[model samples]
Target: MTNTQIVIAELPSDSLTPAHFKQTTADMPVAGDGQVLLKVILMSIDAANRSWMKGATYRAAVNAGDAMPTYAICEVVESNSDRLAVGDIAASEATWSNFVVADAHKCEKLPKVPQLSNLMSVYGIAGKTAYHGLISVGQPVAGETVLVSAAAGSVGGYVGQIAKALGCRVVGIAGGAEKCKWVTEELGFDACIDYRAPGMSKALRAACPDGVDVYFDNVGGTVLEAALFAMNEKGRIVCCGAVSQYDTETPTGPRNLPGLVVVKRLRMEGFIVMDWTQNDAKALRALQTWVDAGQIKVTEDIVDGLENAPQALIGLLAGENKGKRMVRVAADPS
Candidate 1:
């Protein structure tokens, strides 16, 4: 059997584009001991994929000549382990490819549910990341003012709604008018400021009159710097992602960090969602309740074809995707 895959083309440098990847064909790997062969159904394009190319951050590097790193939903074609069965739908950290040979230890069967696609969009990595960062790290309380950067994106969108559920006044900073409208009118954010607008600092100041108590940062650059200036006493900064500086040679950082942390007694923390895996079941149950009752919403920007995976990732890094970036490789029989 043949498999189509994308692999790192050369040593990575700053400002990655689709050209950094090269498409190739290879013989399919047979399922070996304690392994499963998965037919790729769909995959996610995430900011972490960009970091994987430039050495390692919180994990090992993706060596050149290896498959491009990605998180994907897969269907079990064959299995050599007792934990998984053939035909089970599972999620795994796989390659940007048509098929993958993964350790059965690495794949987990997805819960059978109505609206499986919707579940994947909202309750998968994006949703889980938001929940873990907000509840576990930020520890937001009622009546506090919460601010989120990248407010229209996957994790940010979920963070806004979840914060509101806890009775916090939510303000968001997105890129444009449309996203600001979506966050405020549709997602129930108290107010969402467009970071692209002139006088963004003034806008943020006006939107957050009482100062920001909890800040969820996804696209950390100058936006974070602005948030730092507006932080309240004992505020919390949850460093979820830094998409804005992902491909930069020298990533810019917050300049006002010193005074804010010292004067405000702020607790700023960064986390990887995978570290909190033991608590996922509880988070998922709560997320399910919110999603079922229309308290949370989901959005996806899907691109079709395995061949277009590189381009999809490019769009994700460029902030072209309106929500979670997804690539549909094959039809889901379920």
Candidate 2:
């Protein structure tokens, strides 16, 4: 049978653009010992894809001539391992493709949950990353005011909700008015500021009048600067992502970082989800419980077809996605 894959043929030295991807065809691989064949169901698009565009030298997780790296929900079509069944749904990091041959050891059994659809979302890696970043780094406490950048994004969305659940007053910073509304009304953020508006610093200051105890940063660069200025004494800053600089060839440096940290005695930390790989299943279960109880909300933008993968990735960098950006390579034939 024929198999299709998205390959990164040319290296992208600058920003990651869709033009870097090259689609190709190949023969499907047969199931090997301790491996399972999966029909791709859904795959996520994240800024990390951009890092892989430079090839594997810097990021060992991805390489040239290799399939684009992604996190996906898949259906096992064939299994040589005893743990997985033909119809079982599993989540794995299997870039862009219609079929995947994954080591049985690498797959995670998707647990049954109330909002099953959100298991691939709020209970997914993105959700867990947000949760851990906020709690482990931001360390919000009851009555503390937490501020989050890109508050409408998948990670930011969870950060806001998690803080609110922890009894902290939450403020969100997004690019537009609609997202600002969702931050306050839907996600229960105490307030939201539109970063694109004039006087963003002044607005953020006013909205966070009590100062920011925790700052979950999804969009770095200028937003980081603004958050630094408004941080409360001894505040904690979580460096979740630098999305604001993803599309630029030359990323802007944060000029006010030293002042913010030294003057306020603030603490800032950066973490990758893989650091908690050992705790994924544990975190997933906790997030799933929250979703089952309607305590956390997840949104996903799904683009159909493997052919759309390149553009789907491009859309993510352009801020076209409201939540977890994903590509749907196939619908359940059943």
Q: What is the C-alpha lDDT of each candidate?
A: 0.87, 0.82
Error of 1 at 67 (Å): 1.5
> How far is 313's C-alpha from truth in model 1 (Å)?
1.5
Off by over 4 Å in 1: none
Tens digits of per-residue lDDT, candidate 1, 1-334, equal: 7999989887567887767889999899788999999999888888888877777877789877888877888889999999899988889888988999999998888866654455557788888999999999999999999999988887888999999988999999888898799879888999999988899999999999999999999988899999998999899999999999887879997987887799999998999889899999998998989988888877777889988988887777776666777889898856
Error of 2 at 296 (Å): 2.3
The Cα error of candidate 1 at residue 116, in Å, is 3.6
> What TM value does model 1 have?
0.96
Instruction: Give the clashing pairs for model 2.
Output: none
Which lDDT tens digits does candidate 2 get at residues 150-205?
88887888888888877888999998898899778888888999998899999988
